[model samples]
Target chain A: MKTKQELKEILDFIARYATYQLGSGVHTSRAVRNSRRIGEALGVDVQLSSFQKSTVLTVLDPESGEALTRVAAIPALPISFERNSDLSALSWEALDEGLALDEIRRRYRTLVDKPRMDPIFTLAVVGLANASFCRLFGGDWTAVGIVFTATLVGYAVKQRMQAHGVNHFLLFAGSAFVASLCATAALRFDCTAEIALATSPLFLVPGVPLINGVIDIVEGHVLMGVSRLVNAMLLIVCIAAGLSVTLLMVKDSLL
Target chain B: MIVTDMLLDGLFAAVAAIGFGAISDPPMRALPRIALLAAAGHALRFCLMRHAGADIASASFVAALVIGMGSLWLGRGIRCPMTCLYIPALLPMVPGVYAYRTVFSLIMFLQSLDRADGGVRYMQQFFLNATVSLSVIALLAAGATLPIFVFRRRAFSMTRRK
Candidate 1:
C-alpha cells in the first residue's frame, strides 16, 4: 500500500545506511545483514551490493512489485568502534521496537554526531603502545624510551597530515619515515638499536583492513575482500619503503 | 620465574591494547574488557611458546581463539559488537618481526639477483618469513572469527536488548 515516493525514500535511506556501515569499517557481510535487518523492520526487502568505493542498494516493495535502487559512494570515514556498535544496535532496536523510519534516522544522527577521542590523547596512548610493542620484542628500556618519543613525533605528523587530507599511503609512509628516523637515535647508544628501528612503526600496520579482508573473503564477499587486502598490502609496502629509506641512511652505523 | 614473566607479559599487553585500542575509538566502557582480553590472550601465547614449545603461528591461533570466545561473552555484557572488543585486543599479538623480516628478505633477494648463492639464500628467507607472516595473520583472523561462525545467533545479537 506504500506509494512510489515512500519506496524511493526508503531506498535512499537504505543506501546511506549500508554505505555508512561500509565506510565505518564493517566487513561487507555485517553491513548487508544490518541493512537487511533494518529493511525488514521497515517492511521492505533490501538487496545490497557493496564495493570498496560504493554500494548499490535496491529496495523492493514486495506488496506492490515496485523496486528502487540507489548507488551511493562510500565516504572515507575514520574507524570508530563506538559508531559501529551503536549502528548495529540501532538496527536491532528498530527491529525489536518496530521503530519508524524517522525515529531510526534521529537515533542514527545522534550516534554519528557523538564526539570521538581527542587526537592528542590517542597520539600519546599510541606512542605508549608502540613502545610496549618494542618491549615485547625484547628491546631494552633505552630502546623503549627511544621508540616512545619516535612514535609521538611520527603520530603527531600523521595526525596533522591526515587533517590536511593527505593521501593515506603517503601519510603512512611519511609517518613511518619520521618514526624510524627518530628511532635511529638508538644507534648512537648501547641499546637494542635494531629492535627500536623494527618496532617504531608498528602502529601503522593496517590491522583492521587486513583482518576484515580475510573475514570478508571467508564469508564469500570476495570482491570487497580482495580490494581491502590489496589496500592493506599497499599500506604495508608503504611503511616498509619508508623504513627502508631510514635504514639506507643509517645502514653503516646500524651494524 | 615463569609466573613473573607471564605477569609482565600480561601487564605490558594490557597497556598495549588500551593504547592501540584507543586508535580505533572503541567505547570507553569497553577499554577495561579489551585490556583483560589482551592480557589473557597474550600471556597465554607467551606461556605456550615459552613452555610448550609451540610455534608462533600455532600459539597465536590458540590465543586468538581465547580472545574470540572472551569477546563473545564479554561483548554481551556491554551490548557492543564482538568485533569492537576482539580486534583491538588482537592487535598486540600481530607478528611485526616476521612481517619486517619478510620485507627485508624480499629487498635483499631483489638486490642480490645477480649473485646466485646470495639470491637463493635471500629468496629462501623471503619465502620463509612471508609464509610465516601470512599464516600468522590469516590464522589470527580465522581463530577470532571461528567463535562467531559457531555462535552466529549470539554474536550478531549481542547488541540486542536481553
Candidate 2:
C-alpha cells in the first residue's frame, strides 16, 4: 500500500538510524540485525555493508523488486550503552507491535535526545574508579587519595579539551601527562608512587574499542576489526606518550 | 586475612565498575548488574592469582570467560545487549601496571641506548612488559568472546527472541 517515494523516505530513515547505531559503537552484527529488523517491520528487505566510518544500505521493495540505496557517513560518537539499548528496544517495539514510520522516528529522536550524565559527575566517578583500581592493586590510602585527585584533574582537563574540540591524540597525551605528574605527589609524600602513577591513567583505557575489535574479527568483519584494533593501538600509544613525559621529568625520583 | 583481602578487592572492583558504568551511561536499571559482574570477575581473578598460583594471563582469561558468559545470560534475562554488562565487567581486569611498565621500560631502553649492557637489560624489560600486557589483553578478549562463538545459536536466539 506504500508508494515508491514513501518507501524511499522510509528507507532513508532506516539507513540513517543504522548508521547512527554503527557510529555509536554497537557491534557490527547487532547493527545489521537491528536494521534488518526495522526493515522487516516496515515490509522491506534491507542489506547493509559497514566500514569503520561509513555504512551503505539497500532497501528492496518486496512486491515490485525495486530498490533504494542510501549511504551515510557516520561520525564517531562516544560509546553509550544506554543509546544502544534504547535503539535495540525501539527496533523490537517496531517489529513486535507493527509501529508506523512516524512513531518510530519520534521514539528514536527522544531516545537520542535524552540527557546524558552530567560531565562533572562522570569525571568524579572516573576518578573514584581509578583510585579504587590503585587500592585493588595494593596502594595504601595515601596513594588512593593521590590517584583520585590526579584522575579528577586529568579527566577535567580532558573534558575541557574535548569541549574545545582539540585533537584526540593530544587530549590523551596531555591528560596522561597531567595525571602522571599529579600522581608523582605520592612520591613526595612517601606514598606508593608506582601504584599511583600506574593507576591514574586507568580511566583512559579504550575498553569498548578493544572489546568491539575482537568481537568484530571473531564475527568475520575483518576490515572493521583491524581498523578498530589499529585505532585502539594508536590511543594506547598516545597514553604511553603522555605518561612518558611525566616519567622522564621525574626520572630521578621514579626510576 | 586472605578472605578479607579478596572481599576488599571485589568491593573495589565493583566500585570501579559502577564508576565506569556511570561514565558510559548505560540504562539506570543495569548499573547494579554491571557492578555485580565486575565484582564477580575481579574476585575470581584474585582468587586464582592468590590461591591457585595461576599467572596473570590465565587468571584474567578465566575471569573474563566467566564474565562473558554471565553477561550473555544476564543480558538475556534483562533484555539488554551483552555489551551493556560485559565491557564494564572487564574493565577491572585491564593490566594497568603492565601497560605502564611497558611504556616505562620502552623509555628506559631508549635512554640507555648509549650503554650497551644497560640498553640490553632495558630492551629485555621492554619486550617482557609489552608481551605480558598485550597477551593479557588478547586473552581477556578471546576468553570473553569464546562463549559467543561456542553457543552461537543460543546467543543469537537470546538476542532475537521477542
In order of appearance, the predictions have TM-scores of 0.97, 0.97
The TM-score of candidate 2 is 0.97
Clashing residue pairs in all predictions, respectively, total 0, 0
Query: Chain B of candidate 2 versus the native chain B: what TM-score?
Result: 0.92
Error of 2 at A243 (Å): 0.5
Cand. 2 Cα-lDDT: 0.87
TM-score of chain A of 1: 0.99
lDDT tens per residue, model 2, A67-135 = 888888987787888888888888888898899999999999999999888888898888899989999
The Cα local distance difference test for each model comes to 0.91, 0.87
For candidate 2, the per-residue lDDT at A197 reads 92
lDDT of 2 at B32: 83
lDDT of 1 at A25: 84
Pairs clashing in candidate 2?
none
Kindly give the stretch of ten consecutive residues in candidate 2 chain A with the minimal lDDT sum.
Answer: A1-10
Error of 2 at A202 (Å): 1.5
